[model samples]
Target: MRIKTVQAWWVQIPIEESRQHVSDFGRLRTFDAAILRIETEDGVVGWGEGKNAAGSAGQYAALVHLLNHEFGPRLIGRDASQITAIWEDLYNGSRASAAAARGHALPELARRGLTVAAISAIDIALWDIRGKALDQPVWALLGGRSAPRLPAYASGGWADSAGIGAQLQSYVEAGGFRAVKMRVGSMDDRPQVSAQRVRAARKALGPDVELMVDAHGTYTVAEAKRFAALVEDCDLAWFEEPVTADDHRGLAEFRAATMIPIATGESECSRFDFASLISHRAADILQPDPAFCGGITEAMRIAALASSFNLRLAPHLWAGAPCFFAGLHVLAAAPSGYIVEFSLGANPMIHSLSRVPVTVQDGMIAVPDAPGLGLDMDTDVIARYARQ
Candidate 1:
C-alpha cells in the first residue's frame, strides 16, 4: 500500500507524584514519546513510537518535529510494505542507492541518535501497516511466535534500602511476577548504598524470586564491579546497563569480573552498535529498545546477533504502545528471545494508551494473534495528553 499520510504527536502524560519513582533520569515528571501514525492511500493505518532518552523522560518535540517536517514527507507516496528498503533509505540518506549497490551501509553523518530514532518510528509504523495489510500479526509476518506466552519481569524499583523490598514485593503480589528489577548506581550516591538496597530486596523477595538491578548506564566500571561483588551471593538474574553504552571496554571488563549476566543496549541505536558489543564480548544479554534501536527491523537484526552469539534477548519495553508491542512481536518470533520487561511504574504509554490494556497473567503475557498490534490505540488518550 502506498503511504498517504505521516503524522506524529509528542504525547506527554504527566505522572502523579505518588506514583512516580525517581531515577538517574531525575524526577521523571512526564512520560514522553514521539507517537507516529502512518496511513496508506487505501486507508490502512499503522502506529509507531520513538525514544531519544531513558525511562520515558526525554523531550519528544524534536522527535515529533522530525517526523512531521522531515521524515514524514519522505514517506509520502512510498510503498509502505518495503520496510528494509525504507529503513536503508532513511538511514543512508543521499547515499542510499550507493549503499544498496555496495551491499553495506554508507550512512549519513547523522546516522545515530535522533536521526535513527526518527527512522525507528517510521520503520515500526511500516511493519504495523505491513501486518494489517496482510491480515496477520507482526510476529506471524516475522516468522512465527516461539511460544504462546512469554515470562514477564516487573521493571521498576526506585525505593531506598528500607522501602525497596516492600516496593518490589508489591509489584510481585500485584502481577504474580516471579522476577523483578530495581535501580542502583548514581541515584543511591555510592555503590555500597545501592548494594544494600539490592540485598534488602533480595531478603524481601527471598531466594525464589528472580532479582535484577539496573544502573541505567549511570555507573563507572569500578563502581559496577563493587556493586556486583557485594551482591554476588544474591544470585541476580542479570545486571542491566551497569555502565554507559559509550564504554564497551568498561562493560566488557565488568561483565568478565562478575558472574551476573550483563544486559545493556536500551541506550544504543541500530545493529552496528550491537555488533560492537558482541565483538567486544561485552554482554551476555542484548537489551534492544524497539523504539530507539531502529525499530522492529533493526531490532530483529540485533536479535539475530543475539541468537548467533549465544546471547539472551530481553527487549527494553518501558516505552509507548507501538514500541512495546513491537518488542513483544520480536520476542515472540526471535529464537534468542527470553523474558519481557513489563513496567511497574505509572506508564500511560502501555496500559492507558491502549483500549485493550496489555496484562501479564501469572508472570507471563500472551502473544497477540490479532492483525498488526492487537492492542488498539486509545484515541482519547492521544488527544488528551498530546503536547502541541
Candidate 2:
C-alpha cells in the first residue's frame, strides 16, 4: 500500500450574506481551510485537513503550499500503513533517522505552526488510507468506539444580550440541542457587558439547557475572573480560552479562581503543548482541534493525558469535513470524551464541501461506522473554491 500521489488545496468558500454573523473575528466573509487529498498506488484515496487559525477564517495558502511542495513529496513511495513512523519523520525533519533511533523527539526549530499543521494533514490522510485498506472505520482502528452516538452542543451565538437568548434558543430548537455556547470578552467592550448577555441567554433558555462562553482567548486574567464572578450563578458548563494560549499560568490562575470548567487548545498544536497545560493544571476540559493539533494521532495522545488526569475531551470541530470527521473518530475512541461541538453557523465547508450531510438528531451525533473518515468530498465544490 504505497502512496502514489499527495495533493493539497486552499479551498475558500464564501459565506452567503444572509447567513453571515460578525463577532471578534470581524465579519467572517469566507470560510477557508488547507485540504489534503492522497491516493495510494492501488487506487485507494484518502482525505485530510489542516487548520492554521481558530474559527476556520484564516489564510491557508501557505499551509496548502507546505503540504504540496514540501511534505507531500516525501510520501511518494512510502508505506501508507506506517502512519506513526511517517508522522515522526515529518515532525523531526532531516533528523528522522536519528530521532527515530533516539526514542524521543529531536525536532527542528519549525516543529510547530504550519509544519505541524502539514504533518497533521498527512497523518490524517494516512489514517484514512489505513482504514480503507482494512475496510474498517477509523474509530474501529482506534480500538472500537466508546458508544454508538455522542451528544453535541450547538456552537454559535453572536447576537446582543436581548437577541442572544433567542439566537441560542433557535440553535436548541434547530437540532434539539441541550447545550449552547456563545462568544464573550473584548467584543462586548467589558466583562460586565458579556455577563449581561449570558444572563439574558440563561433567562431565555431556562436552567435545563446548559450554557457555555468562549472569549476566543481575548481576555486578561482579571477580566476573565470578573466575568466568572458575574455569572457565577448562571451555571456555565465551561469557560473556554479565557486567556491567550500563550499564558498557561494565567489560565491556571483563572481556573483556580472559578468553579467553571476551563477548556482550551484550538490555538495550540501538538501533544507537548498539551502536556504543559496538564502540568500547570490549567484546564478541566481539553479542547484539541484534530486539524490543528497534529491530527487524530496526537489528539489521541492528548486524550490519553485527559483520561490520565481525570479531565474531559471535547474536540474543536468548527472546520472542514476531514477535520470534523477526524474529531468524531477520536471522540468515539477517547475514554474522557464528552459531547461534540456542532457549528450552528452556516459553514459551506461542512455542508457544501461534503456529499454526506452532518446531521444531528435528538441533540446527538452518531459516530460513522463507514470505512475511512466516512466522507466523500464534493469535487464540484472543491473545483469552484480551490485557490491552489
Candidate 3:
C-alpha cells in the first residue's frame, strides 16, 4: 500500500509539579514531543514520536518542520511495504549530495540531529503499519520473543533540589523496581559535589538495589575519573555519559579508568555513530533510543553491533508512549542482559496517552502482544496537550 498522507503534531505538556529537577543538563520544565502519524492508502494509520534531545523550544520546532516540509513530502505516494528502500532513500536523499543536486541551501541533513529525528519518526510509523498489515507484533516481525518480560530500571533521583528526598525515597520504596538510575553532575564543574550526591543516594537506596548514575555528559575525563574513584565503594551498575557522547576517545579513557560499566548513546542518531562508539570500545553498554537512532530498524542494527562487540543493549527512552512501546519491543526481542529504561518522572504523555498504563511488576515489564506497537492512543489527552 502506498502512503496516502503524513502528519506531525508538536505537543508540549507542562510538568504538573514544576519542582527543580536538576540533572547535569539543567532543570527540566516540560515534556515536548513531536508526534508523527502515517496513513496508508487502505486507511491503516500508525503512530511514532521524534526525539526532543534537550527539550528546547527550537528543537521541537525543527523536528516538526523537518517532518512536515522535508521528510513527509518524500514519503507520500511511495509503497509503504518497501521499508528498507524508504529508509535508504530518506537517509541518502537528505544528505549533502541530494542537497547539492536539488540546489537546496539547507545544511547536510544526514548527520543533522533534527533530520535524523524526523526520519526516526517516519521509520517507526512505517514499521507500525507493516506490523498491522502482517497481523503480527513488531517484536515477532523483528525475530521472535527472546524474553517474556523485559527487565526494567526506574530512572529518577534527579538531585533532590527541594531539599526533600521524597522523590528518591519513593522510587526506592517502589516495590516493582529492581534497579534505579539517579542523576549526577548537577554541580556543574565540580565532580566532587556530584559524587557526594551519589553517595547520599546510595545510602538512601540501601544495598541490593542496582544503582546507576547519569552525568548527562557533564564531566571531563579527569573529573569522571575522580568521581569514579570517589564512588568506587557504592557499587554502581553503570556510569552513563560521564563525558560528552561525541568524545569517543575521552569516553574510552573514562571507561578504562572506572570499574563501573560505561553506558551511553542516548544522543546518538545513527548506526554509523554507534559503529564508532563500539569500534572504539567507548561503552560497555549501548543505550540507543529508537526514536533518536533511526527508529526500530537502526536500533536493531545498533543492538546487533553491540552484541558483536560483547556489549549489552539498554534502550534510552525519554519520549512519549509510542517511543516507550517501541523501546519495549526492542528490549523484548533483544538478547539477554538487556534492560529497559523506565522513566519514573511525571510525564503525562507516557502516563495518560495509552489506554492501558505500562507497569513494571517485580522489575519486569510485560511485553504487549497486540499488533503494531500495541498501544491504544488516547486522542482526548493528545488534544488536551497539543501545542496551539
Q: Write one digit per residue (lDDT tens) for candidate 1, span 1-388.
A: 9999999998988888888777887887778888999999999999999998764656778889999999899999999999999999999999999999999999999999999999999999999999999999999999999898999999999998889999999999988999999989899999999999999999999999999999988889998888888999999999999998899999999888989999999989999999999999999889999999999999999999999989999999999888999999999999999999999998877888888868988999999888997659898999999986
Expressed as tens digits, the lDDT of each residue in 221-320 for candidate 3 is 9888988998999999999989888799999988877789999999898888999998888999998888888898888888888878889999888678
Q: TM-scores, in order shown?
A: 0.98, 0.99, 0.92
lDDT by candidate, in order shown:
0.91, 0.91, 0.81
lDDT of 2 by residue, 207-241 (tens): 99999999999999999999999999999999999
Query: In candidate 3, residue 238 scores what lDDT?
Result: 95
- Model 1: runs farther than 4 Å from truth? none
Instruction: Answer with 1 or 3, whichever has the higher lDDT.
Output: 1
Model 2 alpha-carbon drift over 4 Å, by segment:
none
